[model samples]
Target: MLYYAPDNASLCVRLALLALEIPFETALVDRSCNAQNGPAYTALNPNGLIPTLITPDGPIYETGAILLWAADQKPSHVFPAVGNPARAAGLAWLFWLSNTLHPTLRMTFYPTKYIDAGSAPLLLTATRANLLGHFAHLEAHADWLDDTQVSISHCYLAPMLRWSALYGTDQSWFDLGKFPRLLAFAKRFEVTHVADQARLAEGLGGTIFSAPTPPCPPEGSAT
Candidate 1:
């Protein structure tokens, strides 16, 4: 498999595959250089998104979808098997993370994308409040939602928390300390080889998180 990852969105899938002991090569797409919009990368993921996995059959895009596919490749604690109640729960969390939580963070980080310049602050405030509500919901149900052994959501959530802390909003507003379980889950990956390598490769200067409010190019969105 050839993993086409950009700055940092690909870390989730890479970590999942590493946990499964899967060996795959990487084709780094330089989002900073607008590589994702280039003819080659766009041909792979028409959406011009980061982290497109090239499998023998075809390509897979989207962080959540790629993480799910990677976990399904082998039987492990990272994901529950099909038809199982736990599997159903996993799917729900993955979808929530992608559709609901991720979008909120995107808005918080890049509020300018959703509204006019003069009203960006108002949008950021409302969006950050809404995002905190989502975080509170996850925190309230952290026990069943987070896996001590590490799971697909962990890969997706950790970076989100990191983004929450670093984005247009400050950490004081969304204190990670309030979500101990989720914070711990994300922190576990911080010290791992997979996390460090992805961070360094992306020039992230830290853990596996891209620019929360990176400059706009001819394109928009880090996902």
Candidate 2:
């Protein structure tokens, strides 16, 4: 399998592949690198995004799609192909992350794309409020998202929370004290061997966001 990803959005999938101990080649692409928009990359994904997977079948985009495919290929641990209700619950968080939370955070951090950056202070404020509200929501229902054993939801959420820290969003927004279970879940996920692989792939020596800001925080967080 060939994986094409930028440093940020691709980290979770990279970690998942590592967790499965699947050997695959990695291709790094980005705007600074100008690789994602190149014809060579575009040929793989017309959407011109990173985290495109080229398998024996073909190329696949979208993080959730790539993740489900990876899980299906492994099928036992990464996913439960037996149609277990737990599997459905895990998949629900994957879709929620992809469709809801991710898009909201994207807009919060990329308001300049839709509005003038100079006059978009209210947009940023609104974005921050919405993001905090969503984080609070996640904190409230942390238990349902976890199992006696870890599931795919753990893999999907870590990267999103990491992105939140990268944007200078207060970790308090996650209500770590109130969401002790989620905090424990995150801690366990971080120390895994797969997370190590992702860090190495992303050229980080330790955790995904050990510093105040992550290398990538959407497009406008730093502006």
Candidate 3:
């Protein structure tokens, strides 16, 4: 399998591949040059999104789908088991993160794409409020994020916390004290060699902190 992912959201699935301990090739989709918007990438994912996994069978798009597929490739110990109650719960959060939390994040980070320049602040403000609530909800389950037996959701979430710290207006929203368990887990994940491999493969520097801002706004570009 070939993992074609960019930075930011790419870490979600990239980390999964690492955690699954699979042998796969990583391809960099240079979103900074609008490479993801080009025809070559679009042919892989008609949606023109980053993070499309080209499997031997076919291309898999969507963040949750790719991560779930990664989880499937490994033993049940890495991901939730089929038909287990945990499977349902994991799917719920995965869907929520992709469908709800991620969209709100995009709006907060790059409001200009979602609203007119003059009105961007309003959307940003509202989106910030929404994101805070989402964080609070996650904080409610901070312990679960670092379970000894990690779930795919845990892999999916680490990147969210990292990005929240980097680009958010109020970094305290992800400050260690308030969101220790989840934030700490994410920070640890970022430093690991596996994380570095994924980041560097995408042309992001060795540490995620050293990664440059994407050339253009990625907000409202995908769900």
* 12-92: candidate 3 lDDT, tens digit per residue: 877788778877776667654777889888899898766788887799988888888888887585667797777777778
lDDT score, candidate 2, position 205 = 44
Candidate 1 achieves a global lDDT of 0.70
Predicted model with the maximum lDDT: 1
Task: List pairs with backbone clashes in candidate 2.
Answer: none
lDDT of 1 by residue, 1-223 (tens): 5444433567667667766677888776765578888998889999886778887659998889888887878755588878667787778888999999998888876677789889988888888789878988987875654445768787788767766766565556777667676666666667677666655544445433322333232222244
Deviating ranges (above 4 Å) for candidate 1: 1-7, 144-146, 169-172, 192-223
Candidate 1 residue 151 C-alpha distance from true site, Å: 1.0
Instruction: State every prediction's TM-score relative to the real structure.
Output: 0.81, 0.82, 0.81
Q: By TM-score, rank the candidates, best first.
A: 2, 1, 3
Q: What is the lDDT of candidate 3?
A: 0.68
Give me the runs in candidate 3 sitting further than 4 Å from their true place.
Answer: 1-6, 168-176, 187-193, 196-223
